[model samples]
Target: MLIVKNIKNTIKYFIIILAISLSLSIQTLKAQEVAIKDIYFHTDISFEFSDTFGADRYNHFHEGTDIMGEQMAPLYAAVDGVVSYMVNPEGSWGYAITIKGSDDYTYHYLHINNDTPGTDDGNGGIKNAYAEGIERGVSVKRGQLIGYMGDSGNAESVGHHLHFEIRKPNNEPINPYNSLLAALNSEEYNPEIAKELSGTINDDKNIVSSSESLCESNTLIKMADYSTVYYCGADSKRYIFPNEKIFYSWYDDFSDVVILGVKEMEAIPLGGNVTYKPGSRMIKMQTSSKVYVVERGGTLRWVQSTSVAENMYGEKWNTYIDDLPDSLFFDYNIGEEIVST
Candidate 1:
């Protein structure tokens, strides 16, 4: 009886220890998970990004979400991670940093700043690329400022932005779009500061006082005090660029964007919004789930099935789609449904 009692006591003690161990494990996991769940995509003002993961690039698929922002904008760590690799500083992954985040995941920040302060010289070097004390093997906290955005290396022609990616422990890339959008600090968007960062608000003080001095057709114009760009059409009306994607599809850089005074810019009658370059992208309305492919002259042909969408845009076709506001429905005409063909 005595032996049996002792054995039972041992068993009870073991059970208690096991329960305590499990509780501790759960608490640890919850702490790490919470830390990761609240990661902040650091930015002082509003920025823009699109989900282009798995989209076809020059050769390989686009593995990252490009967060478009002003040059020198601060970027933050996506999670509590140890800097696994830092300073790739080559052609493609310019001034890149890789972190071995908790939960066996990884985070990548590429196209980091390589430009001198207040200039696109692309030679800011290590001091400018990373935050103070950030280096390989450095332990970084979640939401800590890690680097600055830039358009270095192959991203030189695309404009200043940060190419952010998340990966599994196996190094397979995953889309960071959803997570980033959820965590982005979208407050304090000052247009005056944005215009100052753009350095284009006052480039063209040659205000138009008469019709002859008005912007010519095919010219891009914006108000001196605003950042909205419009395409001055041959019809003597100005069409809105709608968004960055539509604007980028039409031109490379904003070098030719003429700045006009408010009165002159308002003088031109507003035409409809410009559509995406035909076949370059797909779009869907915010009010509807149905996706449409843009055809010539702003015709939107609905894709009848997923297979047809894949056949038209490839395996990662969904990544190419952008959501448009319901108010712009009149800007496009609904064409025939895209069947298997």
Candidate 2:
């Protein structure tokens, strides 16, 4: 009986010690911070969170954090890692680089002017040809200059910016803003998830703006001062909100004005006239005068000037049955042909 009691007491003491050790281990893990940058990461440009996520517009989530910067800004490596995924494809993220960190965290850097190696990111887009330089197959250190910033993607009006993303092993996008706070301060910070923009779909075929539904109680939609007036969304509603970086194709002065990912051309009848089914590959640009169209299929590119491009940005998630053109197409007139480099 004495031996059994002693053994039981030993086991209990061992359990208590293990619990204390585990608690200390967790505190150590939470306290560590990787020394990264010396600048206050601003959220002015592309980092603005919106409801657009692939095809599921309303229910989907924002994928990455956009780092607004001047054209050709230097993009530094956050931590020492090799390029795990390097996709040189065009569109929203023209030339993107994904670096795996030592702590098993993945960091994504997009809108690059060039990649280190001559290897293709396998997307095979237009920006691949613009490849200027890289330090291919070499292990890069933390804060190493990986690439330069450029407007290398699909959207024309978008200034040069870096679309940064941090993901876990499960491939879900973790908000970069939360991490930004820690880099701003040495402690590890928590990220805030954006609230979903919700609204009811009426049976009378009526379409309402997401802002009108998502707008806080005291705020109201107002026009910009001494700026261009325009109409948008399914109901052909005119909007002019200053200080908002809303980008759309600006065709000629006589043409129809349409906003990307706002409302379909078919919804307003005057905006996007043509529509493409979901998952189809198409390239479009809004110039200062008119809209240009391009279609991608196994890499043969051609121009269609008069053809009103169908739903490119908006398909499954951005749908309005009462309107004509889908969210992808932009309703605008062309003044001159503008090509992106």
Model 2 ranges with Cα > 4 A deviation: 1-60, 88-93, 114-137, 186-341
Summarize candidate 2's per-residue lDDT along 1-341 as a digit string, tens digits.
99999999999999999889766754443333333333223222223333222212233334555666654454656667777766544445467777777666778776665322232233333222222233334565554445555555642356656667676666645556556654434321111100010011110111222223222211222233323433343334433322122222211242333223333222323222222211222333332222232211111122222222222223331221112122323322222122221
Candidate 1 backbone overlaps, count: 0
User: Tens digits of per-residue lDDT for model 1 on 215-296?
Assistant: 6766888988788988776445777877898777557899999888888887788766787655667789998999987644
Each model's TM-score?
0.43, 0.33
